[model samples]
Target: MKRPTTGRSRHSGGPNVGRPGFAWALPATIFFALFAIVPLIGVAVMSFTSWSGLGSPEFNGLDNWNKLLGDKVMMQSLWLSALLTLLGVVIQTPLSILLGVWAAGQQKNRAVLSAIYFIPLLLSSAAVSVLWRALLDPNFGIPGQLAGIFGGDGNLLGSQAGAIAVLTFVGAWQFTPLHTLLYQGAARSVPPVLYQAAEIDGAGTMRKFFSITLPQLRNTIVTSGILMVVGGLTTFDTVLILTKGGPGTDTTITPYYMYRKAFQSFDFGVGSAIALVLVVIATAISLIMVRATGYDKMNSAQEGI
Candidate 1:
């Protein structure tokens, strides 16, 4: 006997029903191929060649890589980049978390406080650089005047150590608000029951924060730390505008050095190699952070629960 006809036939659609998934993904695939994949491949290929912008690229295998290994300036740039990343993460993380927690717990003036905190983020990097440059001017800047009052020179941008410190501080100042916002969202998502339970147990604010708030924000902290590290490593505009990697390459982080090599010196090959190295370093660091924090496992366990 023939089966009764169904409203829909599974065999009729078969796997064809899922064929449209590729169609939906086509635009994104094309975009990634054209922009990300293509450029990455081009950069990788160019890293092995001596390519002046105007001339045809000449294959010079390992020459650029060899130079990169022994170049003192390049080494300095890499070390400086690492230092900036460390300083930025160290300074921004705790400050942001504290500010975020405080702002989230506020019963009044929350909006106003948030707005004020985000003002630095709203300003363009160029603008911030210019503003700080003026404020740090040795001749007449506020910082310089304060230094003079202390019977010291006000030329913060004139010394290598001072330039590095100022740049690090500027980076932290510009980005801490963004971290604060991230932490605020994470803080607010914590279950109210957790805090209440802590209170009932006679836990004070600091105790509850350590026991509940921080533990809940582990993923966010890791995520933000990675982002801040990457940002610090790739920092350019503010450094470019304010210091121009001045005081004898003291502030010339890897990205700015890469820029100088590619554009100023017209050495695209060396620059491409540096760029690839940076990409590898950043990716490895991010992976290490995720692994150390057990971020993936935590996410999976959370989902399972």
Candidate 2:
């Protein structure tokens, strides 16, 4: 027999039934604060001080920043980084989109080809740079063998234009696979009904792609674009192994410049300043992109249908 509830009627669900509590997020928050936040704070503080590799830091106010502002090399490095990043976006985005859509098709051979295409992503940045370096060598490399195409001497690394072009091409070659994988996964998630409806409407492949598939992949495009922009901005390993910021600092993007200052020149203070600046810039750009693209709203691309 059930008694009538007089003082209070009970709720069927638990108080926190549908919501996650703070405990669920506590571990990740702690980990991020310990690693990312702590280091960022240290770098920010270190940027205001003067330190060689050996001594304790001495506060010098804005001296490091002032010096950086006046440095022509620093200014030029910013321009070069922007140019390389732009080149990467312009060249890789559309290519990845096309490859990803095609790779998402119901073809048996795609499995084999996708694996082969992803091999570059498996290789380390250092290894890829070294392989290309050897392959572009004047006397012993592919360039030398195809001297008619690369010019008689095949000295691609000896000039500014040639070195920049090589860097951009290698970057695109190595990273495009990653972006393609992003798009491929996104492409697969698109509902089949959309495509079926388009076919019934007599929409051809190109028409369906631009009208339906591209719209469905909008969020993924934004995500991939952010990754590309940030990765290109901080490119370091390939430059170190392939160009060494060489042909006389022509390829010295900011990350390599920071490495040169901190490791080679032992200017810890200046290095910290550069590192902090980069962090701020990258963070700000990411935030701007998210805000501008409506990514922060977290709305579904397929919301209407």
Top lDDT hit: 2
Clashes of 1: 0
**What value of lDDT does candidate 1 attain over all alpha carbons?**
0.87
What C-alpha lDDT values do all the predictions have?
A: 0.87, 0.89
Instruction: Please give, for residues 1-305, the per-residue lDDT of candidate 2 as tens digits.
Output: 34333323244354434445566778999999999999899899999999997869999999999999998988889998999999999989999999999899879899788888899999999999999999999889998898778886887988989999999999988999998898899999999999999999999989999999999999888888888889999999999999999889999999999999999998988999999989998999889788867865766654322
lDDT of 2 at 113: 85
The CA lDDT at 8 in model 1 is 34
lDDT of 2: 0.89
Candidate 2 is scored at a TM of 0.86
Candidate 1 ranges with C-alpha deviation above 4 Å: 1-20, 148-151, 286-305
Model 1: per-residue Cα lDDT over 1-305, one tens digit each: 43323323335555333323335668999999999889888888889999889869899999999999999999999999988889899999999999998888757798689889999999999999999999988788987667646346778888888888889888878999999999999999999999888889999988998999999999899889888988888899998999999987888989999999999999999999999988888779878887977879889897443
Who wins the TM-score comparison?
Answer: 1
- Alpha-carbon RMSD to native, per candidate: 4.9, 5.8
Question: Residue 297's C-alpha lDDT in candidate 1?
Answer: 89
